[model samples]
Target: MSLRSTMHIPAVPAFLDSVRLRDIQLPLPAAPDPWHRLGKPQPCTASLKLSYSSAIAAAEKDDVSLSIDYGKLFRRLETDVREMAQHTSSPEHPHHRMVSVEGTRREEMKASAVGQDPRVTAGIVANCGLSLLDETAAGVRRMSHLRQSPRNSFSGSQAPPAPQPADAGPAPITAEYGRCEVWLQLPKALLRAEEGLKYRSVTVWGYNDEAGADALESESRSPVVLEEEFRIEGIRCYCILGVNSHERVEKQAVIISLGFEGPGQLAWGSTVVDTYVALTRAVAEKVDETTFQTVEALATFVARIVTVDFGNERVTVRVEKPSALPFVQRSGVEVTRTQAFFQSHEVAHSTLATRGEARSIEVLVGPASSLTLFRCPKQAALYPLEEPFIVQR
Candidate 1:
């Protein structure tokens, strides 16, 4: 006899493909040094997570040319950043060249009077991680704006451009009295890999002005602004969960990952610095005591803390169970919610966790079959209401 208990649980598509680049150093010029001093190129990190939208036809058909080479993507990012940094955003005072390491040559290349302009400096610095977005990878793959050389892009027979005069120098780039604060999330990337520039520039710059240099972005709009994207990856915790009797008594490991966007950039006029360590600590500690029965409740609780308690404008929370299924690697729920979303909807934050009782979200966990949300209202169109039905871990 067959195990006739498998429920027809409808779920989101699984086993999606993604290409990633982790810990790539982004050289930030005239930014704060490790010692808190200015006028140095502080090296920062950027990570990319590009997921496949279509059926990943290249992999299915066993075709090499149809696939996007990770190596080419890596090289393209490096080249585009270098080219962007080398050029001034404005056409009025153009002195496009690479920022070098030599001490004195940097000084000579800087124009004293103009080097003080924060707008010009921020524009150049922001461009390092900034790019436009499109609906498909074809948009980026076919663009010629970011060619190896601007002049030679048109024809191979063109003469090399003339050299600049000794007196002509690059614009002023100083991190002394001001800074160029921008947060472009590769996490900000959407479905398809489209755009010649290969990325989208959302203005996460802390600067008060919304119409700053980042506004120059063309094409599609980002899901959120470009202020700093905060994250706490690999949050491992043990919690009681499941429908089985053994699972009710024992605790199982759950993996959680969270991402958020902070408020506007404000210059902290102090010697010490602030960080997301507190936010991470707070979320982990609260989630540790959580005894939710389903990954859905756990994920929603995490999103609530980040958006309501931590004051983040928006948050994406993912909670996964490694032991939920016998053959499957993990079963999980991912939810994205905003501060405004919670304010208007009371049910968004009504699930309370107390020391007195055991509780789990009233969710449907049937397998590959019809789904019925026990507690969700018929009109609930909010994120977690009809959340991506069990996005695989």
Candidate 2:
């Protein structure tokens, strides 16, 4: 995709506070290490600063339910980190004493160490943090720091050396211990308000209560989106996509762009290129079967196909109608959809019917400044009552 043609939004605001965990232990993989044959997990220290937010009311009331659960997050991180250590080998590990090896032995050693790769452990942070963010009371937060201990070599004849920084000058090949450190700062906006609210009756440790509605509004007005993206660009199609009389009678030339983000790797033996081809075909087929009065509808249709038919975790679809106006080169509409969006949409529609409340419900997506109403069917299966009445996408 051409960089010039893509849309860019600079700096998505992240409203949050931070929790710090220093010097926690990590485990090693269970497999016998080619280097550390001792087969026992080593203990290491880890420092992490987790950025999160609690409701202004909850923070004031000292409600743990509305706050991030430090104990739970710690246990999860501990298990993941230790498993990575156990299955992997390091030059400093007890088993990896020799400096040189050749042929099958070298290959076997590398293969055995695959799970121990730094990237593997890094993924623990990337995959785990989002859900915690969702659980936070204010709903917009981030993880600012992630670090793991270093690996140092040790000699059998000497006492294990003291733990050293990963960036510290090279250590002895047989050194035993290393240290991990991570630091992240919460967004200043949240901190500023937190500092203002102090009450003699209650001690609010991590957040403030003084700003009141303004603070809550500011926090709710800006949300942080952590997205991984894939794009399909410059696909040309013909559609009846406009409100004008001339546009309805004739098919107009349009350009389409799509981007997707999702968790989980592709199924084994499948490639991204393969997925793109299939997605393109599905989009083309949908366009052929439908007629739209506006670019927004066309874009929404494409987004639905990617999310529903293709099972994309999330998608952004843009449809550009060129020559709609003589003076203008082109104009388009863009729409974003996600799995959570569909689920919430279904719930909202279902809630309206069963609760016998309002005749219809309009879902507002994102922050207050830019909101889109998600359209849903009037009739559907029973929705779980446990679903929140207000669904935020």
Candidate 3:
């Protein structure tokens, strides 16, 4: 039976015709811990869906052009994800090299302005689990998983059912932020795999091939969401924040929890562009430099800093003041913002997008690392340094 003869089925939406790379499991970098031991490669799974309008016509003619070659796509995705997890994003303030325990301990003590500070010690200990990726055998297993699917490609399935033009509407280019457990439906299309193209097996959501149709049917029944979570916890800092004048006289303890929501290549062992440490330090420095009358204002400011500094799709900032009230257990504020929030606020726009030149002292660390010292936006005369800072746990 030819694919052209399979036209008894109803016309599907253009968005429904796409090449999907799902259930991709790869090894991640180990957590940032000097004391951490390198173990077996730990694999984490991620999914991707893509579409090209010209694929339908190309499949009909058995032409390679315009159709997505999923075998090639998957290979590229694996390499890109691995590279993304390996490199440190910041030019200065590279992460401490994972080496001897004694060297790590020495560095830890040196990092704290006051030798053996309890808070600093706690911060360093907490950062042990921060890496998102770990080197693992999961890559080998993933390759096998990709190959397990039967080779039911769109090439030469005896011609596609007539010719169907893509919809004139704008392409489905969207990025939504939410906590949902479901997979996005990739567009269904016929692709002409290159001759001798190894790993041609693709697990399509809906297709009746020698591959398990029952399993595919089960998957087609429930779609998946395209999003992941990035978290930073136990971020403790001292800031001049309080409602009362007495409280404003001295610095109080504040713990921050940051939850980043977005769609991107996130590995368990890779630093999300050193965001966890960078943003946490930025929040502390921002809070320390300025006095806040309310927790709401502090939370809002931190949220804005996170959105701008990291270029995250969405952020949720929770500022906890454990010793705010004598009798109360804790008092704090939680604020959430999307990219749209910064776009809407004029102050946020300037804070994130605007970078001005001002006189300040620059400090060189080691042979390569250097700090770009500058004045805070609100306090031009203060000369508060925003150097790359790290805190692991």
Candidate 4:
């Protein structure tokens, strides 16, 4: 049976265009803290003996107090560094590392480290000692003059060196937010229809705080870092919009659809899905409850559908409800559907086409499900010519 040209679909609201979108998926089994997970917990104690020289050894017996919670210290340092990394700075600005250490023991250590020799300072800095090696080396050099002065007092003669220039290379991209990685396939029919069309995909990685974003961006060489650190997964999806005409001036309504894997984190998945639904609804309200949808809205929708990995070029969509499962464990549903199902619906129209033919074609390719609607008469003709065209069940 032939398909009906126009159907009464429920109206979906439009969304704010300012929303961020991403298409990359992260891996799982993130890195564990070596010090916390593997280090042996031993009681910490230290005694200080100060002598001007062996001949002048002070007769005063000195008692020193020290206590260490190695695991807590390491965790605090890790969290601090991660937070510092999240600060957004132009590649030109110097990124400051701020830390807050409380408790009497930590306070005492900080006091001892202040204006002290590099070795003493290094010991007090906790887990980030290695990362701060360069700064520590510089600090040592600055303080060296104090040891050489006639009175053995800090002279403060030299000003610190200027901050280094931001690296000239492209910023490193990492999967610092996601745990799993999934692939998506474009239906054969959609592939043929959008053979040479150009579409852009963007991924914006956000964090609980600005600091988190900075940290992830700074450490990320790709999206994989998020998976490794957070044990979260990632997926790639495409936004297939059905525009009525190619003319930039023409305003036409388009159908919007998304293709993606099952949701990753249950809370995150629900939040993303709700956001997507809201954006789609808003766009539908703005354009004809039938036509135009922003790329941002569609991208946000697909971001929530991450479930499982179907290997290379297989389409999968996921839905998660962490709170819905018994015992409140991490849980979600993954639904696998071929790209062919989505491609049949996304249609594109162009003004450049001859009366009976389409002017141009654009296809949405990725791991998620998307919609392609026909906007112009010519597009309507080209929509069905694709290989693996959809067969209405």
What TM-score fits each model?
A: 0.39, 0.32, 0.37, 0.18
Better by lDDT, candidate 4 or 2: 2
For residues 8-32, what per-residue lDDT tens digits would candidate 3 score against the true structure? Answer: 1112344434555567654433222
Per-residue lDDT of model 4, residues 1-393, tens digit only: 111112111121121111111221211111111122322222211111111111111122121111122344344344532332232222221211211111001112222212111111112222132223223333434544444454553445655444446652212111222111112111111211121111111111222232333454353212100110011122222222333223221333222333332322212222232233233333233222111123333322332222111111222333232333369554444444443433343331121112212233344322235445423332333333333332110
Q: List candidate 1 stretches off by more than 4 Å.
A: 1-125, 128-229, 261-275, 340-350, 355-393
Runs of candidate 4 with Cα error greater than 4 angstroms are 1-87, 90-333, 337-341, 344-393
Q: How many Å off is the CA of 231 in candidate 4?
A: 11
Q: What is the TM-score of candidate 3?
A: 0.37
Model 4 RMSD vs true structure: 24.7
What RMSD does model 2 have? 24.8
- Of the two candidates 1 and 3, the one with more favorable lDDT, higher being better, is 1
Residue 293 in candidate 2, Cα distance off native in Å: 1.3
- Residue-pair clashes per prediction, in order, are 18, 19, 32, 64
- How do the candidates rank by lDDT, highest first? 1, 2, 3, 4
Q: 1-393, model 2: which lDDT tens digit per residue?
A: 001111111221233455556655444333222243433443333345554332343466464554656787777676655555542445333122111111001123334343322222333432234234444532322211111212233445565556657766321111011111232111111111211111010001111133343343332111111212345566667655565434543467887777654321222101232245567766765575445555765676677667666666667788887878787887888888775776667753343234322123344433456656653212111121122232342
> Cα deviation of 391 in candidate 3 (Å)?
39
State the lDDT of candidate 1 residue by residue for 1-393, as single tens digits.
111111121122343444556666665443323233435444445555443333255555564444446566556566644554344343332222212111001222233222222223333433332221121244433432243354554765776555557655321111111112332222211111111001112222122123344432322112112233444556667766554444654568887777544322222100001323345556667766656556777787777777677666666887888898899897888899877877887764665444213433344522436655443211121223223342111
- Segments of candidate 3 deviating more than 4 angstroms: 1-29, 34-227, 262-274, 347-393
- Computed on alpha carbons, the lDDT of every model, listed in order, comes to 0.42, 0.41, 0.39, 0.25
Worst 10 residues of 4 by lDDT: 223-232
